[model samples]
Target: MKEQENIIHISNLEIGYPIKGNINNTLFNNINLAGSSGELIALVGKNGIGKSTLLRNISGLQEPLKGQINYFGKLKNSYSRTDFARMVSFVSTEIVNVNNLSVFDLVSLGRFPHTNWLGKLKPEDVNRTARALEMVGMSSFSRKHINEISDGERQRVMIARTLAQDSKIIVLDEPTAFLDLPNKYEIIHLLNKLSKEENKTIIFSTHDLNIAIQEADKIWLMLEDKIAEGAPEDLILNETFNRIFEKSNLKFDKLKGDFKMQKSHHRKIGIYGDGPHFVWTKKALERLNFMVVKENESGQYIKIEKENNLCKWTLIEDKNIKEFSSIYDLSIHLKLQLKN
Candidate 1:
């Protein structure tokens, strides 16, 4: 494959934690990477894998046991601290404490590399900070203190700070860890927009596989024994990725993009009709039983109905027709019947 004309080249990278008795410990090996400008890349792996370690190595916070990172045709190690700061900025899972400082104050620190010795903001700095705040939708809360914000809000503030740095590449470690589903998507969307609109490179680590596959321009898959990197959908569709995260017995399903497990007891249920009918019926059955199977039940007609500007579903049990608006409500009714 031809190398991207404008890429930040990182070669032969190896990173691991230090230890005395654990002499043979290492995370990954011989990693060569190039992130292009205006691309969104995702770094993903199991929990104990070295995703953060790689990010820190590139940020120069931790030195790799062996390797080199070149930024704009210069060795990363050769750049002065100020020059390094000017080249890239970072956001991690670490929480900050600037109790009295408002959002603008926190973001203003991103301009320090370009500001005077007294940390006075130039007009350019003001414009950049304002734009960053507005991009993250934190402009309305500019005066709000960091200490008095939600985790999701704090996250946006941190991204705004990285934007204020005005660097070519921004590295974030699990920016969506603290977010719930909606906030998670929102933050990812904001980062993607920033990368395209500002023509900056954005790399972040995340456990959100579905979003990663749908959104990332590139994906770096870190496994226990080997590492895989490509476009998010490419790595996913090539059958190289596996599901690693789980809940209480919620095993990963690489095919359906959900969790599945064996049934304690199977469901004796019949489904009829087509289109939306099967969806709600399947949902109701799944919620009511450990496992649901479809067969022709002798007398019940659980089928579809479409009314004026609405979709309706009805069940004919014991020669009576009962209607429902949502599958979840149907599930609740089925759950009651299962109990009895």
Candidate 2:
């Protein structure tokens, strides 16, 4: 949906976990994903579905067994470790090795790409590191050791570090796993805003299905034996969600935007106006299981209501009729009527 050159492109990628027990089994096959600048995408998949592996490949931490990866349209293998570091930064869910480092020092690792051979920082780099810490709300804790912070705080610190790196693309693996509900919302909101304000592409793997569905500009969904990627709305409308989660016991409800028991209920009421008033009335009625009916009001007793005006419906009995004057009037009257 965004118009820009691709920052990350994987053509026929193949990935597999390198854990000791099973090092040969690939998660999925022949995968392709493209990420553009300023886009926020959720990398989603069921458990053991290769979401992390996919993230690893994008961050250049792992190589694809087959196919090619292009970072900023250049082949990934062509870039040296330093070149890769300059182009991408990652926040992994795996245990961090930081312990003795101060929060400031930890976050300054992001500036590694911009430093000299001895990794000495310039005044400009210092300013960028400070700003990065400030962006993630960790400025006050800059002098504290990273081990002194809570898991969620450490997560923010990692994000700050990524900001300092100033890479064109950032890859986060399970960023919200340690955060509480409100914190998760805040972080996602911040990430969304940052992606636009900074004009950097952001891709993160997440287990938060609801958040992914609600906020992501695009989604890479891992299905059993396969993977799917596209805009969230497009995937939902095309029933890709149902297939991805594939469970008879749990199902996706398009309207509710969640997995629930499949159900069908009907409402049978009808009458209306146009514009905001009509639109809202229909929604309210639908919510209450009322079937809305619309009809012509030529010679009929039906009347459509507007501000400073009222219309009676001739189709139904006046005693059980639902009517409204105007959008504003209707809101007030409905609140008052429902309040008691």
Candidate 3:
């Protein structure tokens, strides 16, 4: 497969806001990164990190403290505001005051950079706006007032606005901040689809690290001390998350691709089976602070077997066997046994 071309590149970039009198407070420096077309990149970090500031610098909303950024082979600082708007579109977390403006009207605002001084929407502009609304699955609600829609709908509308702008690169700052679980996944899925289908570069800052780990083509992990950028699996394999979120009580589960709080277990449980039932049974046992082992040498063992559509779980101890039809029932039995 051919490698995608780079849309934006940053070398030795320093990012932060300026201080009035004292030295400028810097969050990160010496950053080197590149984003390619048809890619979905997630900027993930803990709160108060510089994910937002880095996005701002890349999108040209603010000047970098030092170093250089190149957008489409041109200097980032060289483009006029209007010219830059044609290359990159930004969506912020700030709620818009939608006083009676319809969704279509809101999306059409993205075309203002290309419009004449009168800001009239040409036929092509109107068509592009409609397409953008459709792209985000909000075409049916194009005529609805922005205030009449839910928070998730508003977020989709904002994304549609960026689409209508026809920029090759799109940047969003915490777009899923106020959304529900399903909506958050939906928005990220939509962005992933758009990046592949539309061949646009989509970068969004998010606190949802799990979703980013699962969905993003590339992850830019910002830590208090450094920044690491790579494919999600590469970063995980390199144990980058472990280093970035180094904590005594936390462990990153490579199998589950999630972080878990360390727990103390007073008992160990042996499990037998090699299917979904066994997997879930192990999970349930672990939740109760029971360590799982493979062999029955521990004397206490749980066996799971599926016959036809029904599954049976049996507990064996001291040459005695007790069976239960469901894992829930088995769990209840274990709780009682542990208490005794």
Candidate 4:
């Protein structure tokens, strides 16, 4: 397959705000990143790491303190406002609660750059707007008022609006913010589909690390001193996440591809089981600060058995043995035993 062309590039970028004369409160610097057509890139960082600021800088909503941003091999400064809008579309995190705006009208607003001086929608513009609504699965709600839709549906409408703009690049700040779990996954998956099917370069900042790792073709990880850009797997293998929360009590689990609290174990317990039951039982025990080991290595142990498709957990300590039908019961029993 032919590789997609690079759509945006950043070099030596420094993002922040000017504090005083000849002084700037730089959030991060020396950033180098690139995005290709048909690529979905996730911008990730801890809270207050300037992820949003960096997004704004690259999207042309804010000026960088230093360095260059190029779009389609031309300096970003060279493009006129309308031309730039035609090439890049930005979606902010703010919720749209307009009481009277219909979904179609909101999405049609994206054609502002392409409309005539009188702001009239041509036949081509109307077709494009309707197509965009279909692309984001919001066609059925075309006549529905914006304030009447659920948050997830509203987010889809926002994305459809960008699609109507028909820009090569889309920049969103926390697109999944305030959405439910299913909605979050749906929104990210929709972005993934759009990037592939429409060949659009989609970039979004997110705190949803797991979903980002799973869905993004590339990731731009923001740190205090520098920004790291690469495939998600490459960043994980290089231990990049270890530095994200260096001063906090959170530790990234490379094997699990997620973060866990810094836990201290006071007791060792052996676990015996197979398949998912064993895996989940071990996870449950570990969450309670139990050090899981071989059954022969510990004085206390838990055994999991399946009978008629129902799971049973048996706990053994010294010469005492007790059985429970659920992990919750076993956990409670263990806690009580510890207190005694």
Task: Estimate, for each residue in 1-340, the C-alpha lDDT of model 1 and write its tens digit.
Answer: 2344344777887787666764635677788787888889888887878899989887778877777777775787688887788888999889987769899999989997888789999889999999999989899888889999998999999999988998888999999998999999988888899989988889899988778776788888886666778886565566666544433454546676544653455446566656656765676566666344454554555666667777666766777878878777667776776688
Question: Which residue pairs in candidate 1 collide?
Answer: none
Cα-based lDDT for every prediction: 0.78, 0.77, 0.89, 0.91
Clashes in predicted model 4 = 0
How well does candidate 2 score on lDDT at residue 225?
66
Taking all chains together, each candidate's TM-score versus the true structure is: 0.80, 0.73, 0.87, 0.95
Q: By TM-score, highest first, what's the ranking?
A: 4, 3, 1, 2
Error of 1 at 149 (Å): 3.1
Candidate closest to the true structure, highest lDDT: 4
Model 3 residue 224 CA deviation (Å) reads 3.6
1-340 per-residue lDDT for model 4 (tens digits): 2245458889898889999997999888888999999999999998999999988998899999999898987888799999999999999999999889999999999999999898899999999999999998989999999999999999999999999998999999999998999999999999999999999999999999999999999999987678888899999999998778888888989998999888889899999889999988988888888999987999999989899889899998899999999889988988887788
Q: For candidate 3, lDDT tens digit of each residue in 4-76?
A: 5548888999989889865789989989888898999999887777889999888888999999988887896
Better of 1 and 3 by TM-score: 3
- lDDT (10s digit) by residue, model 2, range 159-212: 899999998899999999988997788778778888898988999988887888
| lDDT sort, best first | 4, 3, 1, 2
The top-ranked prediction according to TM-score is 4
